[model samples]
Target: MQNIGKIVVVAAAALSLAACGQQAKTETAAPPSSAAPSSTAAPATQSKGRECTADDIKTTGKFGEVPTITIPDDCDPPKKLITKDLSEGTGEGAKAGQQLKMNYLLVTWSDKQKLDSSFDRGQTFDLQLGAGKVIPGWDQGLVGIKQGGRRLLIIPPDLAYGEGGNGMKPNETLVFVTDAVAVTAA
Candidate 1:
């Protein structure tokens, strides 16, 4: 039988490559799957009333639907990777080194064009958290999130495709809405 899970992983990889200029690498060659929390990480502070948060990202959408994201009026990208939990999960929180199964939508920050979405394939994308299997933004941003939770990630170019962009513009920030479907022990 066709593994929907594998299909999802390939879709995620292809989408990531299209959005960012990352060279293709096999999952086995990826770095270790765990990120140690850093003491110098950016501080998470509350913002202007209901919308005040460190990432400064806003969104509106329902489950299984594409979400619309709004950046600050100035449109300046965050310096660090920003992760905000959109919907809470009931399962155990994901840990570094675990394989995460998820559904995701990737979009370009400049034009807001969707680069990829697992929802289209009706499958769940899977990756080892903190491993080099994906970009630094994903490796770092997804840590500590619980399975079944939805999160928004705002990634800077350095963590994404860098100066040599993939299918996107150079040094452009990227946005993603990710749903954590499941987590497996490493």
Candidate 2:
């Protein structure tokens, strides 16, 4: 009779311990898929935002009166921009006021020729991510990337310098090889 009682107590304790082990596993696993997860947590790559495709860009390539643009494949522009949270973004990153530091080189896809460049400087320019601080194409192009990563920004004139092109030239589409070096607030 005493042995039977001891067995019952041991069985209860073992069952409780097993339940605890299960709870631990559940707690540590990544939060359910839908939650935005934390900022530092790498954003899941499932969200597609407004960044234009080479096709969309090439199609919309002519803006205002700028020039026709052609972006190289090596540029790495997203076929479709995939958006996920960075520490902060206004609208999938397209909205105004988000600030970022980046390194880039501009090129033409038609001849795969280097058009203009910033990468050669090994410098990063600080600009508002979604803000009008930069051109609309840049504003629209950066819509869906996280901080500390690189993406190619291809700007058609409509999204670029546009019609008069800051007086540098008139209506020309632009292509950029952007390295999103860092992200910060406006």
lDDT by residue for model 2 (1-186), tens: 010001111211222432211232111111112122223322233334444454443322211112233543433334332222222322233235666665555543334454443344344455655434445455556665556444545544344433321211223334554555566566
How much lDDT does each candidate structure score?
0.59, 0.37
Compose the digit string of candidate 1's lDDT tens values, residues 66-156. Answer: 6776666444567678898898787778887899887777766666666656676576677777655666777778888787788888877
Q: Which 10-residue span in candidate 2 carries the lowest summed lDDT? A: 1-10
Each model's RMSD to truth, in Å?
Answer: 9.3, 24.8
Q: Candidate 2 clashing pairs? A: 63-158, 65-171, 66-171, 66-172, 67-171, 67-172, 67-173, 70-109, 98-129, 137-159
Model 2: per-residue Cα lDDT at residue 86: 20
Highest TM-score against the true fold, candidate: 1
